[model samples]
Target chain A: MNLRTLLEEKKSSIVKKWVHVIFEQYPPDSTNFFLTQKDRFLNPVGHAISEGARDIFNALVDDSEPEKFYPLLNDIIKIKAVQDFSPSVAISFLFLLKKVIRVEAGAEIARRNLTPELEALESRIDQLILLSFDIYSKFRERIFEIKNDEFRRMTFRLLQRANLICEIEGEKTTPGEETVITNK
Target chain B: MAVQKPEELSKVVYTFPSTPWMDTPVEIKKGIFCWGNKEKSLKAVGFPNPRQWSVTDEDWKLPDNWKEIFIEGLRERVDKYRSFRLFLDICVRCGACADKCHFYIGGGDPKNMPVLRAELLRSIYRKYCTTSGKIMGKVAGARELTTSVIKELWYYAYQCTECRRCSLFCPYGIDTAEITILIRELVNLLGLNIEWIAGPVANCWKTGNHMGLLPHTIIDIVSEFKEAIYQVTGLKVDLSYNRKGAEILFVHPSGEYFDPNGNVTFMGYMMLFHEIGLDVTLSTYSSEGGNFGFFTSNEMAKRLHSKIYAEAKRLKVKWILGGECGHMWRVWHQYHNTWFGPVDYLEEPVSPITGTKFENAKSNKIVHITEFTADLIRHGKLNLDPKRNDKYVVTFHDSCNTSRAMGLFEEPRYIIKNVCNNFYEMPPQTIRENTFCCGSGSGLNASENMELRLRGALPRGNAVRHVRDKFGVNTLANICQIDRATLQTLVDYWAKGVAVRGVHELVGNALVMKGEKERTTDLRGDPLPGKEGE
Candidate 1:
């Protein structure tokens, strides 16, 4: 059997193991919560991990273009980006899927001699790790941007109230030469 | 070739570390922690052990007698406040409050769990105060109060917004906020405080406001508002400052003077007062309604709050009307009478226009603006045209203090439903008394802690995102001044395209004035809903 059929046959187990491994990166106390809690609103971090893992696995099996992975990668990365995780540890979950797949289906894969197919699938996972890095960097940059913007926005209205910031007038309109346009 | 399946690869088992929580060392990571208290701010307030220090430093430069002082302060607080003592004593660690914290929900840090956040101090409490803890030691969940534990306490105490969502879920009525408050007070004994809180406390203590706006500066800013009001409504609403015999003294969180959303809400109050011809005077002496000192210590809160009643007495106002603010009302409703009681100087607040007695505020004699306005609408005292707010699809975020602390659930909603044409409620769990915090409450809304604030904001943001997706909610209306200032950044980051505004901003937008100009725009100078072509 080919890798696609094998992955499809073991889709639920593979995805479950993948999510389990991803959650292991968190503190041991939180692992049970990240695994057990199912409410999306109540446990957003957990939801992102489980849902993002499933979505990434499906997209990989379906041969969806890598660009489709950005949003899926971004969903989990955004949570970890602000968390206490360092960059390497935050992005490490994306790389853990390969090990999970190997563990869950190693016997089936070797018996079927699907090593080449597995290597091909593993390369796609590597590509996703690179995508996660980009998403992680973007969020970190956005956080810094938010910090700077908050400082400016906090005092921005105060500046306007204090008359510290003046509105520079555009080129003065010539009397009777103002261009009037009809709304179409 | 025989495939060698790994010996332990049958199933994944999560191995929880053998080290118990007490043995797990605290690591104060950056982006989550605030900068240490500035020496100038600590000295300005006459707090003990004023000195420069950084959280990132190896040595926190604490006073040598810090531990003794901390234990003494804790003992005094536990004795003085029965609730603090009860909270420290009665927790069963039922885990009901574990998932309730917005910080824990967002960040997934086990430490952020309300149960554990409390235990960060409770462990020390166990080691020092309780008999079992002192005798049994680590087995009894007690540990030594080392410098590491102090850092942990400082880190987590500030993490709590004191929103009380956990307390609502607790079976024993344990208020983690009280524990956080007590821990903060103890930390302050060692001169460990965050700048966002210290700066405001110093400013409010010295200048009668958080912004340090002197009387002239406040008047100048009010005159600017006067001009803006004229531009909007074509009426010169009279504003009295420090004038005697005004009948009602108006105190507002000073953000209303300069914050864009708050300015419009202030304009709303001015317009409402003008329409009703109410006798009210704004005070430069007690210029700010927000008591940042409440975030510091009970004594400091009293010191900052004293000015309001003093100003009311000086102006000879019968009662006080506070502007839209969160913790200010918490301080007023919960602590005001206790701080300065038999407040016989000010009469029970009776709305001069509607003749409604604010019976709830009879003791403290300070009426929340929402309650006051809701009464006005009920009495048909002010002319309102809700259609002017047709552009906004409004959702009300019940500020944590107002809803959970004061049980002010319906007043703001009554006001918002009357003003805005389109209104939607976020999920039931995320509203009313169970509302999530704006994440910046309790003075955690500093720029340095942006990551922490944004992470803490997730639950509220997620709820907003839900409504924005389902109902296209475009505007988030709230009554709290801190909500007005902080929720905008929150919505911008989480639910893009949604704008945050005060409920009274909508009141200002929809209010029809007697001598108003042919209306072209709302208070923020935006075109009226259907008048886009104009």
Candidate 2:
């Protein structure tokens, strides 16, 4: 499931249009714009998913099995909880990946491709976003719920970090170490 | 870490000249100009002592009429608001803004905490205004507004620089400073504003400035700087004031009218504008660029902003340029557009020299002096001689309101590098959006609260000293006039030998104005010609 190769064969116009729409949807402010625009993958959704895939792929190629990648993905999802990322948004991100892969790699890879592998990844991200949103929504629900300043502060850092990660990679990366396979 | 005892905090006293208040005529009884029992009041408040945490007998007694007047003022301001929905609706209070505060990091005081500070206003709003708040009350954890709470509000509201750094971290993007301003406005309505601030506000109302300096005094100061400019650059650039038909009107903080360091920047701005062939005028009627009304209430803010607009209209200038003052720019950049509108006379500012349209300015009508200068430099229109500033190692302190609230980061740094050699930056954490306030911001530099001012300034002084010691830096340059003034006092008291100057002053010194020798200040310490290299 080489998502990059799949994205490459697709008509550039459809990819370009979708990329434009996603960017317009989440117009990057000063902090996140550079991560998506300046990178080799100009499309934010593609850039994010590819980065995630590249990290996992590199880890797998390094002789680390799927077991290491799954937990790593889970940890990233936990971070997404802090970012107040929506599960729907994460699910939408996966759909974007499927769309890009279908456009670039054609129908065969789209049917048998990265979808199954990314399902758990999307679920993990969705759960994390939901958990973070719950915490954030509850915290903001009441003023007195603010027991100590530290609770509010820690949650904020989590959200800020989550937002940065989601904006950059299009998916959260694992918290712990993962294998890295260098092509060189 | 063990918490220090309240007694352990060092005590410092501030004494004001008695003559100014003593001579106040009997006729002016109600507002700031009226004289009161000075020594008794001073002792009652414990002028130099570390303020007691608890509100005590020392709180100055206001005339019975004062509260009525204050509440009337607040009612007037609240009535002016079309909606409080934005105020009530925004602000999730995740506390991402906690670490962003300089005062919070510097003092480690929980009260200085931005979230907690905002909660003070939020709690009050919930108790009185909100339907959910009224029904739930203590169950919802909403607290009643008492005199003690009002006093606490006064104390905390003054602490904020109104920098808007917290807004950057906010997910919904709430500005806590706006809440602080509203709290202060409400407090002022209750006739409970700190006497020190009220005096300045009144002075600003009476004399077109807070410092109470006369128009002639402003002219005298400008003339003296003109002489200095003449001796240094040989340019007979006329520093005109209250002149009609000038293409642009320049407004600056009243501190510039008195302080030498402040005046230097003022002269620098004039020299640069002259060299660029700008048709600009200075108005004594609205000479003070700062709106203390911003500290007080929205009505005052509107009133203060209106004065500038009226002056510009009276002068019939196409555009108005603001001087280097932090909160002034915040008000200008954030609210000026909405507050003063239908400014149909002025075209949206496209730098005549740069061709860069200032579309992002709150009102495309008025321009901040720093942005104007930076744009001119960016366009290659201004020829600067950087050799003039070789005497000192310089770094810029991005004014919090300018950098964080407005996203004006690169332009000033670009101006700094072009104007001086050896332009270095403070540690990355302290520059740009993360810059610290110079303790005296947000009207905390009031003469009455010198101890509080010193306590607040300690962090900035420490940062400046760290840079000076590590980098052998001799001068700290910034674009905000208040930062320069506040830091001048801070550096003098804490980090001696390090001088604070404006970015424009450095540029003005570096620019080869028409009468180069007569009108410009020297880049080096002495204006002597042969002292260039040595």
Candidate 3:
């Protein structure tokens, strides 16, 4: 069989392996918990990872364009963005798919003289990795934006109180010039 | 290590940690922890060891005898509160609550597990306060109380929002939120407090509210609300400050008068009160209904919350009417009588308009706004136009304190159903007593800890995402002030178009007042549902 037929035949096992390896990045205890828990609300992170993985795999095999993967990639990347993972380590889970595809269907491709087709699939995975990089940056930027917005809202009352109450009589300090205690 | 067989390529190795949990060192990650209490804030509250320190520092600059103080404080608490000591001793660790924490479910941090978070303190309790622990040591799951242990305790203690979700599923009825409370009490002895809780505690103690608004500042903010109210309803709403002998004293979280979302809720209260002609007066001194001190220690909670009863006595109101806040009602319903009780100075809260006695609050003499509003709606007192709220396909998020502690399940919903045509409940497991936190309750709602907040917000946000995807829910309603602030940020991130609103904001939009001008917009100045073109 050619690469497409091989991939379609091996789709379930490949996605399963991809999700399992992705969960392995968590702590051993967490990995076990993720594997065992099936409730969506009870184990949201696990659900997100598993569901996002299958949808992303199907999207890839269907030869969908990169933009079609935004929601799927965003679901998993959003979780990893807030998690205690470095940026490279956070998005690195995408790279593991190539290794899984090679391992799951590599021998079949070789025997069928579909090495060029396998390379094309691997390049698609690379494109997904690049797309995840853009998603990671968007989420990280969204987090910072959230922090800024929360600060503005929290201080909304205080700022309004300051503006409507009175002018500074003595030191005349600006609103942003409070003695902020910073710790290195 | 080449794979000889193709099946070996998918071989997954599951290696358990060699070190026991007791021996595993704690690493305090950045973006997950809060900033330490500033010296000025600690000094304002007369707390011990008022020195500037950072969680990232090598030396936390604790009092030289911080260990002695922590041990002494823990022992004093164990002696003082029987329930606390029982909670410390009775946990069987069935792991029933292991998967119940929102943080654990969202972030996958094992330490965020309710059992493990409590064990951070329980292990120390075993080492210092128990005999078997002294003899068996790590075999009995005990560890020495070192600086690293203190750091870990601080890290995980703040990670818990004290929502008590885990306690709901505990077979042994182990209240992990109490454990987190006790841990925070001990850490305060060492000056290991986060700035978010400490700053508010100091402000509440000194300026009568968390935001440190002076009496005039509060009045000015209310005046601005008055202008907004006049512009919307075309009639002036009467407001009084500390007016003696008023029939009721209205105490709300100061955020209600200040924040944008809270301002809408505040306008809702004004419209309701004006419609009924209720004799209610606001107090600038007891402006804050939320007790941040409750998150710190019992003593500080008492100190800050004393202002409510004190203001009531000063004003000589018949009874007090509380506004839409989550933890404030928890403190009122659960701890008010114990902290400052016999409440003989005020009378029972009887609805002046509907003549319905709030028999549930007979002892405390403080009535929740929903309980009061629901009673009015039951009596068919206020003319409500639910169609005005058609712009919002709303859902109610049960604030943790109100749902678990106060059992206030139906009052807010009753009010919501009366005031809105469309409302939806989240998943069965994620509403009412089993509700998830906005992930920023108990004063963890600070800007610096955004990642921790977002991580903890996932379960609640995910449920919201489901409802929004399924039912076109555009508005999230609740009775909590912190929810008003944090869940807005949360929905902005998770459910992009979903807006966070207070339950009362919907009420204000739906209430049809007598002699009101031709209304064109809701309390938020958004165009009304049917009046959008005009």
* Top-lDDT structure, candidate number: 3
Model-by-model lDDT, in order? Answer: 0.84, 0.59, 0.86
Chain A TM-score values for every predicted structure, listed in order: 0.88, 0.34, 0.86
Minimum summed lDDT over a 10-residue window in model 2 chain B is located at: B25-34
Q: List candidate 1 stretches off by more than 4 Å.
A: A161-164, A170-184, B1-18
Stretches of model 2 off by over 4 angstroms after superposition: A1-184, B1-93, B131-136, B352-357, B361-364, B492-495, B518-534
**On a 0 to 1 TM-score scale, where does candidate 2 land against the true structure?**
0.63
How does each model score on TM-score? 0.94, 0.63, 0.93
Better of 1 and 3 by lDDT: 3
Span of ten consecutive residues with least summed lDDT in model 1 chain B: B1-10
lDDT tens digits, residue span B386-429, model 1:
99999899899999999988999998899888988799999988
Candidate 1 Cα lDDT to native: 0.84
lDDT of 3 by residue, B226-250 (tens): 8888888898987889899899999
Q: In model 3, which runs have C-alpha deviations exceeding 4 angstroms?
A: A157-184, B1-19
Candidate 2 structure quality by residue, lDDT tens digits, B482-534: 78756765565545678788887888777866545543236323542346343
User: Tens digits of per-residue lDDT for model 1 on A75-181?
Assistant: 78888888766676678786678888889898899999999999999998898888888988898887777666666666665555555554436432221123332
Error of 3 at B82 (Å): 1.5
Which candidate would rank higher by DockQ, 1 or 3? Answer: 3
> DockQ for each of the predicted structures, in order?
0.28, 0.01, 0.31
lDDT, residue B195, model 3? 94
| Alpha-carbon shift of residue B264 in model 3 (angstroms) | 1.2
